[model samples]
Target chain A: EAGVTQSPTHLIKTRGQQATLRCSPISGHTSVYWYQQALGLGLQFLLWYDEGEERNRGNFPPRFSGRQFPNYSSELNVNALELEDSALYLCASSLYRTKVAETQYFGPGTRLLVL
Target chain B: GIQVEQSPPDLILQEGANSTLRCNFSDSVNNLQWFHQNPWGQLINLFYIPSGTKQNGRLSATTVATERYSLLYISSSQTTDSGVYFCAVEQDFGNEKLTFGTGTRLTIIP
Candidate 1:
């Protein structure tokens, strides 16, 4: 089975512009999560979607938002981007609701660069 | 929120050697995962051990949930093991999201 897939491996945008990242989870998976990994800063949780509902969001600003589709794929939107927003955006999926515990599988990540 | 820390920050080893990495979390967790981020930036799931012990080939992991710590052991390490090892956890005993550690950078010499 395919693990997880992401689109637009690399993106370059300027400040105040808008950017969107996409992710398709592994087949038969329900939960989709987004994270940001900056150069110095550690990986920070961005958003979590389950069964097409926004379950939880991190401490990021309102500009960082995302939604999950019926097929369990997700899209992360970053509006009014800033230089600090440049990072590797990763998406992970898990066999969450179907199993007792979850083992998240990650994608190759989309490198977002804001100038 | 839960905080995860990894040490010794970095490690350098020779081929055919062994190494151990540690991860400590601030609070209790029900979902603990160990991943290896390759040089090309792909996060590969290494283990999904929340508690107890598990072994896979030359790699093994042990998590003492009560103590809030986990150990990853790589025996007879190879050059392919050179990369960053990360430890992530899910809080509230749920699997919606994960908080990641800073990670340990391991380099193996030939």
Candidate 2:
């Protein structure tokens, strides 16, 4: 089975602009999660989507939002991007309803550089 | 919110050596995961061990939920093991968001 896939391996956007990163979950997976890894920092949770609904979110601002499609693919949108927004955006997928201990497979991630 | 702490913030080892990394949480957690971030910035899942011990080749992990701690062991380490190892945990209730530790940065020399 194919692993989680993300588009735009590298992106460069100017400050105040908007950026959209995409992720495709593995086959048969129903939950998609978004995380941000700022340089020299640990991964921070951003959002969680399951069965086409937003199940939970982190302490991120409203400007950091995203949605999951019918096919379980997801899109993370960062509005009013700031230079501090430069980081690697990761997407992970897992089977819904499984035990919380189930491992989440991650994608290669999209590297966003806000100029 | 649960607090996750990782020990030995930094470590350096020669190739073929062995090492152990630890993570301690302040409260009970419903989930515990280990991830390795390579130089290219990919978060690779190493294990999702809430309890018990599991091994995958040279990498292995053990989570003693009752003790609120987990351990990751690397045996006969290789240059490919050089990176940052992160331990993340999710509480048993509420929003169930994953809280990450500061991570242990490891460098392996040839």
lDDT of candidate 1 over A12-111, digit per residue (tens):
9999999999999999989898999999988888898889988888889999998999999999999999999999999998776633668889999999
lDDT of 1 at B18: 96
Q: Ten-residue segment with the worst summed lDDT in candidate 2 chain A?
A: A95-104
lDDT tens string, model 2, B47-74? 9898899999999999999999999999
Looking at model 1, the pairs that clash are none
* Candidate 1 chain B: worst-modelled 10 consecutive residues by lDDT: B90-99
**Candidate 2 wrong stretches, greater than 4 Å:** A98-100, B93-96
Q: How high is each candidate's TM-score?
A: 0.96, 0.95
Per model, the share of native interface contacts recovered reads 0.72, 0.62
lDDT, model 1, position B100: 91
Model 2, residue B68: C-alpha shift (Å): 0.8
Q: Write the per-residue lDDT of candidate 2 for residues A1-115, one digit (tens) a residue.
A: 8999999999999999999999999999988999998977678889999889999998889999999999999999999999999999999998766444446788999999999
Best by DockQ: 1
Compared with the true structure, all predictions reach lDDT values of 0.92, 0.91
